[model samples]
Target chain A: MPGVKKCLQEAMAIPGAIGASIVDYTTGFPVAMTGAAPNEDHEAAAAGTADVVQAAQSRSLFVSAVPHDLLEDLIITTAGGYHLLRLVPTDFDSRLVLYVWLDRLRGNLAVARRRMQTLAEQLVV
Target chain B: MTPAKSPGPGSLLTRVAGERRTGALVVGGTPGGTVYLAEGQVTYAESAAAPGVGELLTASGRLAARTWQAALDAGSAQASVGRLLLDQGHLTQGELELCVLGATYDAAYFALAAGTAAFHEGVRHWLGDVVSIDAAALNRESGRRIRLLNEIIANPRIDTAAVIPVPRPPRERVTLTAAQWELLVHADGQRTPADLAQLLGRAGFATIQELRRLAALGLIEQPKARATDNPDFVRLPRMRGASAPAHRHAAPESPAAGVSIDLSIDVPLDGDPTRAAVPAAVATSAPPVSTSGDPPAERPRLDRRKPGAKLPKEIAAEPPQPHPGTDEVLLKRIRTALRALR
Candidate 1:
């Protein structure tokens, strides 16, 4: 199993990836992060991503009404970029999600979604 | 010029860091905690006010209580419990490191209040060292958190009080953040912020901060000190000095004396999870069974001690029973839900 740093590195390698973070949504803190420039407010963005995940999990409309309802992933598309969040499955009571920011011009949303799922499953932290 | 030379939480930590010492610093006094150092870096810390890592791991459903107990039993003497857990595949190396780091920071926050810390040479926690946190960095972060908490929460003491939900939310239509909603669901007027943190499997500081936010928004009632009403207080006099005047006067004041006595007994018993779990048959037999069916002999024995000294009849006869509280049951359900997520 890859550690958090390795997971972040792999995430950064994804096509058109601008930034990646393993965010603990419960506390709105990043477990590990990569790819953001030195001046970028990655922590603030990670905190915002946490809110997005929380909103999906808590709101009735966003929550899946199936018998075993759990959020799978979240995606946000803006004019310039795509934000992808995939929950990490863990035996521990951790509310962690892998978030990747992709440039709209270079990234394929479909490919990013599929790639994130694999990373989420394989990521060890 | 160097300021008052006192061996406090910060000074001791600074001293250890300067010396690059390896051992345990037992910080004692009110709100005391222990910080374990490995070559001047903090590897583990524990506070009486904060839940330990074992509790955090167990309560979070990441590891079962039995699993933790087994690790302690097996690896405590050797100081390789963390290694054992990692070797067993219970948690990955990264997960263990993160868990230890999170718990150390959480404990250090509450433990670093102004107080003298004593150093114990060569002592170490069983988990050994997965990662070393710089003492200076930890102090700064803890200070930052305190400042953040103070800014959000007007009253710092509210963190220790029992949090209760507003009986009627001020707004007819309200929107709650995920943390606020969870805090509301478990508010229950009984749990403090610290308890809520454990219940929710979140960091202690995070829970308190969320609670402060909730309070600021008036989404939840400000936490209040628990009521002074003590059921045990009444039981004290009744158990000792059977002819106590206060009891005689109190009994006459109540119209339904016999029924009230039973109801009062029920109230305290029901509130106590331990006593409530005892079967009726076993409970009824408990008082008599303690003295071998001789209350007279027990009375003399009890009288030898100070007044109100006899152990409550229920306590003396408290039987072993499965006493899972509501939160434990909820945590189990949460674990099941988490399993489904996996």
Candidate 2:
């Protein structure tokens, strides 16, 4: 079974990866994380991301087509870095999310997405 | 300003500072908790872990949006928040307490997960002290119970984001508390138990308890965890309509049978109008004989007796014959007899 440390290490290896975290979106709790950012609470980031996902899903426009499923992935590009949120499929109750912070200058968006997707498929809960 | 203790790295305040922002960080426990303020204002709070304050008030369907908006707009400063909510009559003390308990737990579970740095902020306000209770302990206990319930139900997937799939009804229609029924009915494949608590305006612990109980009773489907490569390995079950039982326990024989038993005991001669009429005749006949001495007193006694027996017969006979004139005559006779006696 691949553990959280392995996941974080692999996530960090991606070019320009600054930080990575495994988050339990439901409770906005960070199961595990790796990064170096002053005063940043990864747990809060996980929770805030969950909140963002919830806000997005609440729109009626998404309701008709999405089958009420959890968010599969979310990407937000900031001036300094890229924020990636990926929702991993699990039991209906244990909805887990991955939050990745990538430096914008060096990170390849397409490559990062592909790598995260592949990694997600192999993660053993 | 003895630099109110600088929140350590990863504390709630540090995170807020890192983001360079400010807003009330409401934390919830199980039954009750406290609120913390920053900069001479309310910043953090704790309540029960179930339906949060915002959700409870909205779900209750009693307070209006305008009232909530007004209270929030007034600011979350400890003193102001309470006074404003009270002034608007959005909630009574008891109701507010319940809401706070629920909200505190909800917020605390989420907030604690975010980090404990939240408590290290330079400025802090303890609403627990304000309310005259150990809000922290209450919230902590509630939070722990909710987490335990989540684990016991083994539905780790049903967190804040994942919606709860509806469960199949039981074959032997089981009895459920009103809250459990409501929870089941409201499971819209989108709201987690926590979310439902907020939507339903219930405490988080209560919601989890009901869910755990239901799952234990085999009334709901439990999700199985699947291995995946994703760093986030949790798997939320994809919800689909649950299968109905092949044979439903027949609806409980109407409670009317029990009601009938009560009725029979309450009214022994319900069916016999003639038997009921006999009492009226006896009473009237006796009243006439006694009228010579004190007609007024005798008349009232007769009047009271008449209703006990005569009213039933009258109701059975013509069904609606006793009208305004008869009632007037009866009153007049009683009055006249009283005057005669005086």
Candidate 3:
């Protein structure tokens, strides 16, 4: 199944993957989640990802100066893990955000970002 | 409304899941629905209020109506329509699953509402299972949707009442989502959100959310504001002790509820839409022709709500000579400023 659940399963397969979740940032709701969480709670982690994504889209400090340009993704680095959030763009209101927690020392940030971009694309169709 | 001994649909589903049961839980209500679970995970749900996955797919132009019907006829009997759609290449694996996911959650939101439920053993949804939502997540999401709707507009009346757009919005420019624009275009001040949802072939609850958002932004007429028929009538807040109706309108009571909605928007003040949401009156200036049931002569508004301030043009327009109520706008501001100081 080339779907969100399957995509999340694939996200966990990425080396050093801790946890994964798909969130609707518009209301800070998690569409589906899997794997480990920063606080050992997927809902809380999903909510935090939504907040960061919301800020990136609305706040001038994080928003780009380009006209009508949308944000691609956001990554928060901690000593132990890397929290990656990739936005899913759709024809309709696509406030859907994808988040994956990665072990900092074991995971490759570049590889994780590329994999998430692919996962985000799978969600739209 | 008393199902005191009976478990709600939410808890029923939880119990079903705990037992690893497979069947359909039918919720009987005005617009009742059914939840199809596989081994306790919610595989699909359908509500009378919302368009099902088939309707959602066809309405969005992704799948043809004939194709959907064909798939249904082919796989509905064995409860494998989802697999048939994928096998027939009518919908991709991702499309089928995502649609099922969205439709399941959307329907479950309404299905889990206050209703009596009965479990039919071994019954199945024609669409079959694609993606499943655990009972906990399903409960949380539904609860969140309810909270989000109430948070958008405190008054419950707007959800059930007819959606009526203000005849003449006080603002010069207004922003709205495309879905909201469509709902407004179709609003006849007669059809409620549920009615509009079926008419538009959109998600039922999503339309309700949009309507509430529109009301919060003052784009649609509030149920209480319907009394003052004329949008141009600036129905000032009645003086506290004045002979206003003893029954308070639910809309204004929103802020007085101790929990304030952060209506202090961060967007620019220019062309703000919240202006029309001011208490009862939506007009920026005094009605030259007071078509309202209550004439300006006796029920003149003395308060200036920041919501209805047409500052830029009012400064350049002719003086307020015809309507005496316009002058009180300044006085009300001064009074408010004084109160703020204290």
Candidate 4:
């Protein structure tokens, strides 16, 4: 059961991880952040991440017809990096998103993605 | 907008943080809230206008009332209730921290508004701190929330007014979040957003925000907007009665009783979330007016429904038929998604 600080530290330790932050998508602000950010401004990165999460959650364009099939994670790959957003599932309205930025050359997408899943689960239950 | 006159003493949070003090700043107003700081960083906050951490937990069924009571009794003395819950395995660290963050931002939004504040040194919140936030960051976040809300719809009075569904909604169909759906279904003409917030065990700010969203979508009646002659009864989804819910124009006035039963019992509190997710059928009935063609003197024109009424299960159980345009929209999305995959 990692506390919030421990969770962020663990996320930073992931191979090739450049930055990690837990954002309250509802409010569009980062609750806790660690390591380096995309623009050297975690605040801007947090806002950008929130816009994508909000669009995915609210728009039918991204939502599936399959009942109970909620969005799990999204991977936004760039020329040099991968931005992964894992939606934290809670019973109530936390609307938290665990976001990690990774360097494409150094990080294995499969490993980083899987590590985030474990981290997200451990962050809660 | 704050009055241009008598300048209120600004938030003490910044000054306190500068001194690295630990205490609470109680903002005074009609619906004021308190912000708790540990070493000048915000650890927790609670507003009378919003549900606190405990209510959020019990209302969501994450923690039972008795369990909360037990936690309170055990940890109240040390101001370590939050830690006690975590140690007892009642809630995880992330759950506690995020919830604290949610409650803190929400309370601080209001606390920052009621400009007058006085700081008491060394006071701590009973829900021991999980994470701390910078005073500037908290202020920035609150400002962002206020701006975002106004960007959606600018009426602050909507927070306190009775949420009456219009007799005729503007859109043929509107999408609602599960939270929005729950709010509309339970909205009695009498319950304000704050009242509904406590009943639902949701954050008051969240309720206000969703109401603003509903107002933006033109789903619920806007405060002091021209009277649609909205009857006291809720216009539940028009599936059950003889009335035509899909009538693009107002259906000829059916007795309000024909379409909706005035909620007699408090809709079983959080009795069924799956049921709450089902949107209320859009009702399009003519305004209930006296045969005299003039509105009644006493506005509660709708018939008083018998006590012990539950929204007919069929109204919620039957899935709405997909609108013809929806399939096309879905297909377009699929095409776009598939092309991206390729």
Q: Which candidate achieves the best lDDT against the true structure?
A: 4
Off by over 4 Å in 2: A1-125, B1-50, B76-79, B88-90, B113-170, B226-342
Candidate 2 backbone clash number: 62
| Runs with alpha carbons beyond 4 Å of true place in candidate 3 | A55-71, A78-80, A90-95, A123-125, B1-5, B170-173, B198-202, B224-342
Query: Candidate 4, overall lDDT?
Result: 0.70
lDDT of 4 by residue, B132-211 (tens): 98987887887788887898898876776667665577878778888898998877555567557756777777788899
lDDT by residue (B87-165, candidate 1, tens digit) is: 8888776677667777777778877765567788787787878768788877876776687778886766466655666
* lDDT (10s digit) by residue, model 3, range B1-342: 426567888888888989999999998764567888889888888776666776677656677868977786787777788899888776667666666776777778888876788898888777777877787788878888888889889775576555668767758988665678899987754455665665566777778778888888889866542221221112232122111111221224433321221121111111332342232232323444344556533533323334445533432333223223223433432442342233
Q: Which stretches of candidate 4 lie over 4 Å from their true place?
A: B1-10, B225-342
Candidate with the larger lDDT of 2 and 4: 4
Candidate 3, residue B159: the lDDT equals: 62
DockQ of 1: 0.24
Runs of candidate 1 exceeding 4 Å displacement: A16-19, A38-83, A101-109, B1-15, B118-121, B134-137, B173-190, B199-201, B217-220, B223-342
lDDT of 3 by residue, A6-117 (tens): 8889999888998998887756777778877887887777777877886776566766677767789999898988988998765322357788899998999999999989
Q: What are the DockQ scores of the candidates, in order? A: 0.24, 0.02, 0.37, 0.42
CA-lDDT, candidates in order = 0.66, 0.49, 0.67, 0.70
Query: What is candidate 2's lDDT per residue for B1-342, written digit by digit as tens?
Result: 112354421244335544544344433222223345444333335433333354456556656656765665564444355556655655554344334433543444444443224333443332222232233342344355456565666554333323343345556567665567887777754345654664566656556666776766666544333222121111122212111110111222344432332232223223353354444344443534345567452233233233234433432342222234323323433442342232
Better of 3 and 4 by lDDT: 4
Interface RMSD of each: 3.3, 17.5, 3.3, 1.5
Task: State each candidate's clash count.
Answer: 1, 62, 3, 1
Of candidate 4 chain B, the 10-residue stretch with the lowest lDDT total is: B238-247
